[model samples]
Each structure stands twice: as structure tokens, then as C-alpha cells.
Target: MGKNDFLTPKAIANRIKAKGLQKLRWYCQMCQKQCRDENGFKCHCMSESHQRQMEVFGQNPNRIIDGYSEEFEQNFLELMKRSHRFSRVAATVVYNEFINDRHHVHMNSTQWATLTEFVKYLGRTGKCKVEETPKGWFITYIDRDSETLFKERQKNKRIKADLAEEEKQEREIRKQIERAEQLLPPEQNRESEVEDSAARELKLESGVKVGFALGNSAKLASKEKTEAAKLVFEEPESDRGMKRKADGGGSKSALEELMREEEKKKEKINRKDYWLCEGIVVKVMSKALAEKGYYKQKGVVRKVIEKYVGEIEMLDSKHVLRIDQQELETVIPQIGSLVRIVNGAYRGSNARLLAVDTDKFCAKVQIEKGVYDGRVLKAVEYEDICKIVQ
Candidate 1:
């Protein structure tokens, strides 16, 4: 037939049959050629180029098969690693994805006779986690990359470290519980008597007791005054609204006299005998006047009133709160010292120290900026204080 005639229907049918993988078994591995049929394959074997290729392959047939097997395995594993690195996939499912690449090495040319055999080989070599399910064989890529191994090792190490830290904390807690139990025996009687105000009392890590007798006495005195119908003075205003200015003055004097008498009674208690220092923190007890919002406020002791009562500067520094010693808790940080907060929402925040209860290790801090900036003070722990260099 003429070259133009080869494009006819009969000739086209012949050409179509010669292409594609219809006769996979008859394909040449060394020459990388396929034939149309048995006759065509016989003719291809007789060709000069085919003879030269076959002659070279014949020198070491096993070498050629080994090369093909290696190529096939490498390409298959690369596909599995890239496409299904994190999934457990069926063998057939992976095979389907692998064949999508037209240039992929065919299994027939390799040593593995079937996909099952290749999967078994992969499992045996520990390249993949393999399992036989009811449906079929499933495979998951075994991540053996150096980076992946390192990350896994790091994760395990962190988990182990966390477990160890937790165990240490538990051990510390057990020790604390034992110590508390031992101390409880000696203080049980005193603790029962003090139980009523225990909730109001702040305990410091350091064992220093703020005097309570003065606070209780002040409470009793205040209670007696309330029962006696003592006239409470109103805020000083213009005489225009006063029924009698003289009456107001007389009432004020009476109030002063009553206070002086109370002071005299407290003086017998000897205030200076308990503490040797000033600027210690104390809680303003319940008996303190609530109108100034100092009933439960924190203040630095400017002076001790009658051994138990304290004349203190409130957190604002603008007001003073005078209360019995029981209301005050000694805070952690010392006054006029610089300290950094270590716990709570303001952790890592730096502030100037205003007052401290050395017994309790609790401090009142004055923060000028940030979330803690306000007229009111923040109470924090001595442990939370980060020491400043200068």
C-alpha cells in the first residue's frame, strides 16, 4: 500500500492494534518496545536494534531484572509516601493512584508478579505498616525520614518531662500535707478559739502574728458605743443648714472626748512592745469606719495606736485608715522597695513597693501604668516578686 493509502480504515485498524498495553506480556524490557501481536513480537526480536539491546541484557539478565525491580519499588514507594503519607490505604487504592502516571514502571517488568507480592515485600522490609482486613490488604507509610524521627523523639521527650514534673509536684504536695498535719496537733486548741476570725486572717509564709487582742477590744468598744446611742457627727457643712452651730460644735467635742477616753483605755495595752518597725502592712479591721471605705482596706502602718490599733496610710496615699491590729495582714514586699509581680493577671509587671507584711510575705504594690494602674492597690506574694537589680 502507498503511504497515503496507509491512512485508510483497514490500515488504521492495524496501527491502532499495535499501540497501547494490550499485550503487556509481549513487551520488551531492555528495548522498551511493545508489539501488536505474537507475529509482530517475533518480527521485533529479529530486528537489528532489538538484537543489539538483547545482546547487552544477556550479559547479565539478573542485573537487568534487579534494576527494573529497584526502579519499580522506588517509584511505588515514592507515590505511597507522597500521596498517602498519613492515611491507611488499601493496596489496590494505592496501585490505582500509582498507575495514573503513564511513564510509571509496570509491575509485569519487575520481579513482583502482583501488587500483593509488592505490598508483602514493602511490609517485610518495614517500609510500610501492613495489615490484612476483611476487604483486602491495607498499608500505611512508615515515616522513617530523619526529620520525622527527630520530631517524634522530641514529642516523646516532652511528654516524659511533663510526667516527671507532675510527679515532683505531687511529691511536694504530699510533703506539705504531712507538715501541716504535724503542725496541726500543737496548734489545735488555739486554732479552735481563733476559728471565728480565721477566714478573715491572712497567713504569710513567714510565721509572724499580727496582734488580735487590740482588734477584738476595738470591736467591743465600738459595739458598746453603738448600743449607747452615741451621736454620730455629720460632714462639716455651712451654718446655713445647721439648726445650731453651737450644738454641732458641742457634739464634735463630745465625740473627741469619747475618742480620747478610748485612746486612754488602749494606752494601757502598751502598743510599742509588739513591733519594732514602721511601714508594716495590716488589714483595716471591721470596727474601722466604713464611710471612708477603709473597713477592709490594706494600709501601711504609719503609727501603732495603743499597741493594737494602727494609724495607716491607705493604698491611695491620699487617705489614712486607722484600725485595730487584727484587721491587718502583713504583706510580702517591703515598703519603698522595687519589685516585679510574678503571679496573677499582672504577672511580669513591675511596680514600686508601698507596704509589706514581713510575716505574711504579702505586699501592696503601686503600679503607675498598665492594667494594675489605679487608686486601689494590688496585694501580691513575696514569691511572685522578681528582685530588681537597681
Candidate 2:
């Protein structure tokens, strides 16, 4: 058919409308043209321009595909690295952000069929840290920039250097303290010698200077005389030496005889004092126990005996300890008891006691704050709370 003969206004209008909505399926990538219909696309396929473009593409189609694939991968990784550097987010989230740009490389045109496959490729290639969670697959982009790696290494080196400096200073201070302690003994001896000399000078000024000097000489002579008297009256030097030799021979005999007598005496005392058992180490309750004097001077209790009675000394309050009692009475917080917080963020606020921990001496309370109700606070120490109402 002739062109004008087939181009009726009504026919032309219908063709134009079809062209407006017709899918541009057969497109020439190199020639950059779209045909309106199948017949038109077939005609264009036979055209010289389309044929030339096909010849160029046919020469090395793999190279063109590879270039496009590389571009797609580069654009995707850039988006992921910029948007979700540290976060382990879903691949779809990053893809959606990437597609927001109209010029962004489409995934369907790329080698990866799905986002999950692309993420898996990135993980396999060590481009990202990928993991599958209950929610979905997530990924963190790996930064391969040389400058960033250098900065991280520098930061770690500085931290290690600071630690080394601190350790060196600590060692120096320890050495100074040890040197100071070593000097203390000589310093104390010098002070003692000065004090003795001062005392001798004070005695000389008390009108006994010459007399004290002579008396000291005489005391020294008397000490020597006493030593001589001991040698003459107690035993002759030769006899004393001989006696020491004989005593050495009888040393084992003397020790055995002494041990027998001591055992007999110990048996007699053990019977009389056997009923006197030691007391146990218990929490004291009296004012005397609170004093530093009592802590410094009192001997420790070693045992708790039957029918043993002693006062509990807790600072000022005192309670008598009855050893015969089966159970010791202790104060315990009751449920629903009102208590005042003595410390912490909720100090001065009142709460209802919910539970008591006897072993820890603590309580769980429902704390009320402002319009908020019933906050469960755990392990509030007994000392940190006061019973307001039972």
C-alpha cells in the first residue's frame, strides 16, 4: 500500500495513540532509536543504521556487557558504602535508596538476578560483611580506602604509647617510694643518738654532771664486778664448763621429766576449766563495742557453747544472745509495707514493699514517680530504706 493511501486521519490518530502506549521492546542500544510497532521495528532492524550498530555490538558483545556490569557494581557499592557504612541493614533498603536516583544503574540490567544474590556476591568477594538474621539479610560495607586504614593504625599506636607512658611513670614512683623506705632506718638511728646525747647533757646541767659521770663509771665497774661474782660464787669456770658438758649429756632426760610433770598439771587444769567453753564471733550491739578501744583490746571469741549467754553489742543498741534458742529473731520487711527511700535517684519518695531478701538484707519495692506508676526497683538495701508503715 502507498503511504498516503494508508495514512487516513482516523487511522493515523489510532496509530498515534497506539504509539503513545506501545511497549518499546525492540530497541537499538547503539543507534539509540525505538520503533512504534512490530512492523516498524522489523523494518528498522533491516535498516543500514541498525545493521551497522548490530555489527559493532556483534564484534564484542561480552566487552560491552562487562563494562555495564562493572558500572552497575560500582554504583551499587558506592551507594551502600555511603548510606549504610556501619549498620547491618537489609539489602533491599540500600537498593531502594539507590533507585531513588533516576540515573542509578538498574539491578535487572545487571548480572545479579536479585538483591540477595548481589549481597551474597559482595560477601563472597569480601566487599561487605553480610549476615542473615531472623528479620532479614543484613550487610555492612567494607571500606577499602588506604587513608582510613592508615588513620585507624595511627589511633591504635597512640593508645598503646599512652599506656606505655603510664606504666613507666608508675614504675618510677614505686622506685622513689622504695628508696625513701630504705633511708628511714638510718634517719631514725641518728635521731635516737641525738636524743641520748641531749639527755646526758640535761643530766650534767642538773648539778649531777660530775657525779653522774662518776656514777656511770662506777655502774659499769659494778656490772663487771657482778659478772666476776657470778663466775666465783655460782661455779668455777672450769667446773661450769664441765657442768655444761654433763648437762648436754642429760638434756633429753631433763626434757622427758619436765614434759611428764607438765602433762600431769595440764590434765588437772583441763578437768576444772573443761566446762568453760569459748564464745563465738558474733555481731556486737553495745556502745562499748562501737568504741575503737573495744575493737583494739578485746580478745577474739573462739566457740559458741550450750546455754551460753552474752549481750549483742551493735553500736548503742544491745540484745542478749541466747545460745539455747533454736532461731534468732531478725527484722524482715512485710509485703505491702510502706517504706521511704533513703538514697539513690528516688530518695525521699515512698514505695510499697513487694518482696524481701533476707540473705541480702534488701527489698524490692514498687516505686511511684510523678504520673508513672509501679516501677519495680530491685535490691534496695535495708539500710537505704525506712519502714514508714506496715
TM-scores for every predicted model: 0.41, 0.32
What TM-score does candidate 2 get on C-alpha atoms?
Answer: 0.32
- Local distance difference test, per candidate? 0.58, 0.51
Model 1 Cα lDDT, one tens digit per residue, 288-365: 256757666666667654344456777655486544443444444346666555444344456777777667757766
- Top lDDT prediction, candidate number: 1
Q: Where does model 2 exceed 4 Å of error?
A: 1-51, 144-147, 160-390
Clashes of each: 12, 8
Q: How far is candidate 1 from the true structure (C-alpha RMSD, Å)?
A: 29.2
